[model samples]
Target: MSLKYAVLAALLEGEASGYELSKVFDVSLANFWPATPQQLYRELERLAGDGLIEARTVPQERRPTKRMFSLTAAGREQLAAFAAEPTRRPTAVRDEFLIKMQAMDGVDPRAVRALVEERRAWALGKLARYERVRERLLDGRTEEEYLRDADRVGPYLTLLAGITFERDNARWCERVLTVLGERRAAAGPAGPAALG
Candidate 1:
């Protein structure tokens, strides 16, 4: 999906300045659609020009004037119409890391091990952050309570997906590291080819 649709979905929460929207993307939408601040600002302008969203300028004492945006009726209609469209099939994976993993046999095992360690660290960090978000979303309630009474469920559901993805990543990295480490142990001081 385009940044346009993402922005519109964000505005569905409430009116917000471009800065606030950027923060929202960083928090709630980061799992699905990551956006740079520049991209978000540009999309805000385009959405305004298209009459999908309405903007109001608010004067500030020290900072620059802030423009708060909200979805117009047309924007809601557009989002609803898009939602009605049949879901597309999942896109094919196009990741470079998979290619690197595939070539690990010919490449240096040390480098691949380093990559796995790095990915594991990143995945663990993401899982921690997702847990924090889940806690905040739950507040003092249990999961069942939150799901029953929350105003919106999309963010929580997407966050769950991110958590699951990160868990899988960490698990896969651990498996790769275990295999590589075992080979290194068996080969003693031999080179990568002998380790294989």
Candidate 2:
């Protein structure tokens, strides 16, 4: 999906300045749709020109004025239309790590292990953050209760997806590390060459 749709969906919660929206993207939308601050700012300008979003400048005493943005009526209609469209199957992931894995025969096992370990740490950190966000969404309620009673389910559902993806990533990384560690151990002081 385009960044425009992501911006519109974020505005559904309420009006926010570009900075606030950037934070929103980082915290919530980063899971599925990532955007840089510059990209978001440019999109905001285009959205305003297209009349999909309206912006009002807020005067500040000691700082540059900030423009707060809200979705226009047309924006809501556009978002609704987009939502009604048929979903497309996600394309296969294209990642550098996958390429490295495929070329592992020519690469150093220690290097591969290091990369995988870093990824594992990152995935674990992201999973922990996602869990905290999930808890916040759930508040004091159970999952079923939250699902039934929350004002909007979209964010929670997306958070669940992020959680699942990170969990799987962590598991895959752990498995890779285990296999590499065993290979290294079996190869002894001569290293991978000994195994070959």
Write model 2 residue lDDT over 75-135, tens digit each, in one string: 9999999989886656346578778788777678877888898988988998998898889
Q: TM-score for each prediction?
A: 0.87, 0.90
In order, the Cα lDDT scores of the candidates are: 0.86, 0.88
**Model 1 local distance difference test score:** 0.86
Which ten-residue region of model 2 has the weakest summed lDDT? 86-95
| Cα lDDT for residue 22, candidate 1 | 88
List model 1 lDDT by residue over 1-196, tens digit each: 5678889988988899999988878866877778889999999999999999999999999999999999999999998787688866563445688788988886678888899899899889989988998999899999899889999887788788889988999999999999998887787766545434
Model 2 vs. true fold: TM: 0.90
| Candidate 2: clashing residue pairs, number | 0
lDDT of 2 at 35: 87
Pull out the clashing pairs in model 1: none
